[model samples]
Target: MKIYRIANLAILSLVLSIAFATAACAADNTVPGWDPAVLRDASTIKVMTTEPDAGEHWSNLWVVVIDGQPYVRLGDRSYVRIQRNTTKPYVKLKVADQEFDKVKVEEMPDMKDKVAAAMADKYWMDVLIRHESHPMVARLVPEAAPPETPSH
Candidate 1:
């Protein structure tokens, strides 16, 4: 009887642990550090991309935070097509596994100059401070309508 009880408890613990791990993985699959509402409501955002000119470095762009908000950081020298096209109201955003539509672009004044400088110093890489002059501002506008039928 003692062995049986101990075995039962161990199995219970293992099951609970597995359940917790599965939940964590599911959460991780979504954008990190974002509420679903913010993702749906945000009009502008930064996008992290692979810099074609940097030879294996990441680039950041001002983009629409469509669908859902995910964590994003843009470098000073990112692409401009997405920003320019937003004037015609053509934009999209990919956050995690979801895609956002109707993103707008806008410029934001420099608020992270000190932080950027510090990071550059630590990494020993040069980062441009005149990011605003580089035309790096953009906003993302998501559709307001929810799906008529949500998938179960």
Candidate 2:
């Protein structure tokens, strides 16, 4: 009887853990667009990307907001992986404590100079790498949820 009770308690805990994780990731989309202000104060965000042959990996990246959109600039290796992933444009992001599971990554070459200026303004450390030519800027836009249909 005691063993059965213990097993039941363990199952309950597993269920609750999954539920909490789902809720955390569901706060993902403030879609239409991310107000740059939402992530403006956040210095860095965690980017989760799937490698070509392996599973997903998370990298910490400095974030900057321009015209109410969030953008991150990655170094060569990360940039190469993104280019390889031509089919899927989505990546996961964690800003502060919030996790976004379906954030689309759009590379904006035309905004290169603007993004650089914004990063330089937000991160004083930008001066160190700004001189080098790491020009891949990926804008993070959350996926909007589908519209709910009324019941028949």
Candidate 3:
């Protein structure tokens, strides 16, 4: 009876340690806040990871930071996870080699034109000249939220 009790205590301690270790691993997976400093002066970037069916996601995409916000323009035919999701998507942004995984994404299809006009002025000679002439813009909104930790 004494040996059985000691074994049970050891097992309980092992389980608790496992649980704590798992939690620590999860915490390491996501960033806590929007660190704008990282994106302060980045050039061409691949902002998102492609969905499973999409082929070769990283095309040289330009990023425009306007009024303290970041925006990207994607075409109507673009195969993006954001396009498929009815509600705003959960986004992870990898900018300047740092990953920010706790962002809430919003779609701004209607404001595409307005955003383009704004970008034309801000980016000037260095803007996406081809798209600017056509102006097919898609905007993404990211918010700081509960970190979306990946689960095993």
Candidate 4:
């Protein structure tokens, strides 16, 4: 009986450790010049994940910023394209006058409810689409710029 109790405790500990590790890996931080307020003010942002071609195209998606993190829930067509994209997680974003060439698309399933709430608050027409199924939520993280070589 004591051995069984010990085994259960060990299992619990392992589960907790894994949970914390995953949370750490998905830590939310904003890039220096990329302001979350810009997204919050803008109604829709253009996102280009796949290379431009005859069939594929850019997606105009709604964005919300919760605690300095930017999140987007792609429309059905965009979602399919993003999933099938050979480039995968890399996306180009244009928010208002700001344009980012290579922002990383981090799918954040855990933030579905939070992102939903923020979206509903920001978008007046959210009531019309609130009943739609919750798809995978995405957090946008800007990639670091490569270091430039010093001039001779």
Which candidate ranks first by TM-score, i.e. highest?
Answer: 4
The CA lDDT at 117 in model 3 is 69
Clashing residue pairs in candidate 2 are none
lDDT of 3 by residue, 10-126 (tens): 999999999999998975524454544445466655545446566334344556765556676654433354555333365556667766543444456676666676556556654
Give the TM-scores of the predictions, in the order they appear. 0.33, 0.68, 0.50, 0.71
Tell me which of candidates 1 and 4 scores higher on lDDT. Answer: 4
Candidate order (lDDT): 4, 2, 3, 1
Identify the runs in model 3 with alpha carbons over 4 angstroms from their true place: 1-33, 37-40, 54-56, 76-81, 84-88, 122-139, 143-152
Candidate 3 is scored at a TM of 0.50
Model 4, span 62-82: residue lDDT tens: 899998778998767778778
lDDT of 2 by residue, 33-137 (tens): 455676888988887778777667777888888876788887887786666653359877787667877788898888888888988998988889788767488
**Pick by lDDT: which candidate is best?**
4
Looking at model 3, the pairs that clash are: none
Per-candidate local distance difference test: 0.43, 0.79, 0.56, 0.81
Q: Global CA lDDT of candidate 4, please?
A: 0.81
In model 3, state the lDDT of residue 152: 100
Candidate 3: count the clashes.
0
At residue 143, what lDDT does model 3 achieve? 50
Clashes of each: 14, 0, 0, 0
Judged by whole-model lDDT over C-alpha atoms, candidate 3 comes out at 0.56
Error of 1 at 31 (Å): 15
